[model samples]
Target: MGIVLNQSLKNTIITYLGFGIGAINTLYLYPVLLGATFYGLTNYITSCANVIMPLFAIGMQNSLVKFYSQYKTIDEKSRFLSFTVLFPLVLIIPMLLISLYFYDEILYFLSKKNEIVKYYVWLIPFIGLCMAYFEIFYAWARVHMHSVFGNFVKEVGLRLFSLLLLIAVNFDWLTVEGFVYATAGLYFLAFLVTMFYAFGIQKPTFQFAMPSNSKEILTYTFYIILSGSVANLLLDGDKIMLNQYMIIDNIAFYSIATFIALVISVPSRAMHQIVYPITAKLMHENKFEELNVLYKKTSINLQVVGGYVMLGIFVNINQLYAMIPKEYSGGLLVVFMIGISKYFDLILGNNNAIIFNTKYYRAVLFLGVLLVAVAIGLNMLFIPLYGIMGCAFATLLSITLYSVAKLLFVVKRLHLYPFTAQTLYSIIITFILFILFYFWEFPFTPVLSIFLKALLITLIYVYINYKFVISTEINEAIDFVLNKIRK
Candidate 1:
């Protein structure tokens, strides 16, 4: 718990810093500098790249974490690490060749509904390749318990690059086209920096020999490819599908709403960096009791933190939209809808790590494929009717079903439940805070209104949580911070 708390705290700070930077890029800078159409185009291209990245890497990032702890000797570990690093080439080389063979046709197909996309179609694979390797290298470092630096590169470094690019474009130093290309280049740069950090942690000799578990490793990677694709698809498929059914700028509108909602999830994402490998280690050792304890604790801790963020967003949503450009304000409902699904994700803490690391993962992969179909079908059906809000509806429905199914599967298969009475308490408290504060309006400006409401909400929420002790872990965390402040 010491190392977990230490790294998780650092990562939470880094993730929020990244999100803060992203908020600037998304809400104000991009709209002011790039305009809605180009902003949407940028987000759409990156989303497409994300949807393809899991396939390009072919699940080696997860495979490395799942298998790294199983190797007993340095030689075996080195061999396994080398294989995972090189394994993605199996798909990358062939995929690149295939794309080249039918490049124009592919672009033509993708840009049919949004022709602007054809102009930047080539950046998709470039960014996808970069993103895939970044995760692989990040995982490389995570297996060595060096996730904070990798998290910084992933979270802060890339967004900082975007800020620089935005400034360049704002100054007439580069065209919008150049800005888009520079974004891809930044992803590649981040990947290289992460690779350097990973190798600095443990430089591999690139052992050519395969580990004895090659067969098992390859099999798990194959299934995880489908699982990974499904997960990423549900996440970004809405934006991609929005391109097909609606205009390009609608993607930007939807992106802003989703970004706001995604803040509810930063805690889980940050904690997962270190907790995932630990969960994998515990499962590898068959330590169910300790694993169970970690699982329950993570769920409550995430809910306590994530619920607070959700309350803040929902409470001050009106003020937030009031500050942003009017055009981007249409997706307020999208924020609430997506935020709920993400909260469910938090409540199911480390569920993905548990599933992906264990033998039961195959069942979840099949479930994920079915959910992917449902998500795409829902998006195709709903976006035409509801527009950007429809995309959020489809995502919320698909992700909720997926999450509930995973929760049930984990309970049945491993008998490890992440929910408790305190989980219910957190949910109720979240709604109480939302109802009390969300509708309350201040006579002040949006910024001041947000501060006043958020501060009040935080005070009430924190006092109740500490008084009733919603989560002992959270209580301890608060005490630690208070003690540090006193010191």
Candidate 2:
């Protein structure tokens, strides 16, 4: 818990900083500078890339985390690492070749509804490849218990780079088309930097031979690839589907609302970097008792912290929409639905890591694939009927159903639960705060009102959690920060 809390706090700060920059870019600059058409195209390109990234990497990133701690000998570890790096090429090379061979047909298929996407179709595989390797290297760093630097590069570095690119667009130094191209190059740069950082941590010995556990490794990688695809599809698939059924501009509107909603998951994202590998280690050593303890602690801690974020976002959502363009303001319902879905996922804590690392992961992967099919079906049914709001509803229902299934599976199979009495108390606190803050707004500008409202909410929320000691770990963390401040 000590290491988990320490690194997660730092990662949370970094992630929020990135999200802040992303908010500026998504909410302001993209809409104002590029306008809706190109802004939506930009998001569309990236969303497509994200959806295909798992195929390119072939699950090496997750495989590295799950298997790295099992090897005792450095040579054995080196061989395993070598396999992770080289194995993906088998799939990546063929996919690229296939894309090249059917490039024209692929373009026609993707751009049938929206012609703007035709020219940028190539960037999907290119950026997906870059994303794949970046995660592989990022996982390399995480397995060694050095996630902060990678998190910084991933969270802060990429968004800051995008900020500069947007600034370039503003100065008329780069056209919007150029901005899109440069974004692909930016991902490549991130991949390069992380690859170097990972190598510095453990210089690759380049053992070309496969490890002795090749059968088991290959099997796990196969399931993980499907699992990763299912996860990403849940996150970004709606945007891709939007491109299919709606005009490109509506995606920009959807992107803005989803970005605001995504803030609630920051704590979970930060904690997962460190916690995934630790969960893998615990599972490997059969530390069910320790694993159970970790499960409960992370659940309560993330619920409390993530609940604060959801409160802030949900209570002040109207003010947030007011700050964005009027056209994007219709997504208030989108924000609420997606925000609730993310908060539900947050409270599940390290449920993903627990499921992915265990032998029963294959069962969960089957369930994930079925749920993704359900999500796609829902999107197809809803998007044309209700536009962005309909897409949000589909996302909300699919994610909620998927989350519930995962929670139940973990409980039924492992007999471990992520909730305690503190969980109920945290939920009560969150509900109370949301009700009190949701109806009122300070009589000032959106910016001032948001600041004041957020400040008031933070003070009261922190006080009650501290007083009640909803989580001993969180209480200790507050004390640690306060003591540091006093010194």
Candidate 3:
């Protein structure tokens, strides 16, 4: 618990710092600097790369984490490590060739509405390849229980690089086209750094010989590809699909709205880094009781923290948007929809860790494939009808349904539920804060108003929760912070 809390806290801070830099790039710099069309084009390229990354990665990042601990001998571990590093290339090299063969046709389809995308179509594979190797090596570091450096690279490094690029563009130091190329270069650079760390953690002996359980590992890798792809599709698919049905510039507005909501998941993402390998070890030891406790605590702790982010975003969203250009203003509904989905994601806690580490992962994988189809289908139907709002609607429905299905499966198969009585309390607190602050506003500048409202909400909300002892975990965190202050 101590290690998990310490690492999660550090990770949460790093993630939020990254997100703050990203917010500036998205809301302030992109809209004001690049305007609508270029902003949308930039996001579309990255989103497409993310969607393609899992397939190129061949699920070896996940498979590495699951299988690395199975081998006992250093030689055997080296061989297994060698397998994870090399297996993905078998898929990546061929995919690159196929991409080259169909490059023109692919460009035509992707650039149907926004021909600007054609100029950068080649970046999709380039960025995807970099993202693929970064994760593979990041997972390598995770299994070594050295996740902070990886987290810093993942959460902060990219955004920091992006900030410098955006600044360059803003100051007339570079053109937008140059910014695009720099973005691709940044991803490749990050990949090299992560690969270096991975090797340093455990210098691979390059023993590429096959283990006896080669079949088992390859099988898991195959399923995890779909599993990995499903998550990316749900997160980035809406933006990609928007390019087909509507003006590509609309994604800029949608991106800003979703960014405000996506911040809610930062805690969950941070905690999951360390939790994943720990979950794997726990499951391997058959310690269902410990796993169950972890599941509930994570759910409640995430809910408590994520709930605050949701409140802060929703209550002050109007003011936040007011500061942005009017063209990006139709996203209140988008934020609400995506924000709620993010909260649901947080409450599920380490459910992903459990499912991915367990044998039943394939079942979840099949379910994910089905849901990806449903998400794409829904986007096709809804985006045409409601425009960007419709896109949000489709995402909300798909994510909600996906989360419910996951919760039910975990309950039925693992006999573990993340919900406790305090779960209801957390929701009630979030709702109460929303009700209290949603309509209240100070007649001041947007920044000052947001600060006062947030401070008031934090004070009243934390005081009430502490008084009631809503969660032992939250109470303990409060105590630890207070103790530190006194010392």
Model 2 poorest ten-residue lDDT run: 1-10
Question: How well does candidate 3 score on lDDT at residue 211?
Answer: 75
* Candidate ranking (TM-score, best to worst): 2, 1, 3
**If candidate 1 were superposed on the true structure by all CA atoms, what would the RMSD be?**
1.0
TM-score of each: 0.98, 0.99, 0.98
Give the candidate number with the greatest lDDT.
Answer: 2
Q: How accurate is candidate 3 locally (lDDT)?
A: 0.90
Q: What local distance difference test score does each model get?
A: 0.91, 0.93, 0.90
Model 3 TM-score, 2 decimals: 0.98
- Runs of candidate 3 with Cα error greater than 4 angstroms are none
Over the stretch 1-487, how does candidate 1's per-residue lDDT look in tens digits? 3888889989999999999999999888998899989999999999999999999889999999998988899999999989988878977999999999999899888899888899889899999999999999999999999999999988899998899899989899998888888898999999999999899999878977888999999999999899889999989999989998888989989999999999999999999999999999999889999999999988998999999999999989899999889988899999999999998888899889899988889988899999999999999888888898888999999999999999999999999989889999988988987888777799999999999888899899999989989988878888999999999
Q: How far in Å is the alpha carbon of 81 misplaced in model 2? A: 0.9
Comparison by lDDT, 1 against 2, better one: 2
| lDDT, residue 328, model 1 | 87
